[model samples]
Target: MNTTDNTPSNIVRNFMTALDSNELDTAANFLADDFVFSGWTPKPLNKQAFLTLLENIKEGIPGLSFNIHNVLEQNTSITGTIQVQGYQTDSFIIPALGTPPIPQTASSVSLPMEEVTYRLHDDLITAMDVEHTTGGGISGLLKQLGIELPLAQ
Candidate 1:
């Protein structure tokens, strides 16, 4: 799907493409002004903050890419599974963990499949939520970088 297309599925495809390509402007154009993003971080993110987080991820992870395996649309919502792969090229803190930025080791990590759900209104994405299907969530991703966290009580 093209970025100009506004259909729910198309918008999701374009948005993910733009994000994987680091095209912040194109990605932002697909979102509503009051868009809310949940997942990746502990707190929800608004449109501007979401864009900034995308930029930070792009900077921290060199060669970042998202491979979409499936997309399903129902009514105004679209859900899909994606595989995210990247190499850590610089020191960066885990937003979800809120720890100090860890030095880069140039380690390559391929996060397990994640499910993303996007809700659209008037052709613009208004809400997005992501969940890990397996691999222990954020901690699993961190494990790939040789960082381990204590198990939850």
Candidate 2:
């Protein structure tokens, strides 16, 4: 690995690529110990919780991927847009939502562009916030899968 590969841009790209390829460990390495992940669920996820979500996604959608584009870097933050695509072949567990696992629908979903923001410190990602849209991101994906989420209390 190149020592100079720790640039903000490189780290974000590599991190997302690692996730797209289902290389969880590699992706984990890019996150800080106190990392927080948000927007994928109703609440932010701690490092371990986020990892668990990724594991669930991997199990549920074998070839799931994020097609990232329009990336921008400013200070210690990186922002980008990603289109999530996958086929639901197994149960999708979202612990942060406090809902039961989403059962398989045997359907393919291609979500619209969702903006992602990553804040880094000391070359590791400290926070990731995804922009959720009503007809995009996880909500839209679930809608496409024909599984409606109960209204939040």
In terms of lDDT, the best-performing candidate is: 2
Residue lDDT tens for model 2, 1-43: 7877778988999999999999999999999999999886666
TM-score, candidate number 2: 0.88
Candidate 1 overall Cα lDDT vs. reference? 0.77
Clashing pairs in 1: none
Q: Which stretches of candidate 2 lie over 4 Å from their true place?
A: 1-3, 151-153
Runs of candidate 1 exceeding 4 Å displacement: 1-4, 93-97, 134-139, 148-153
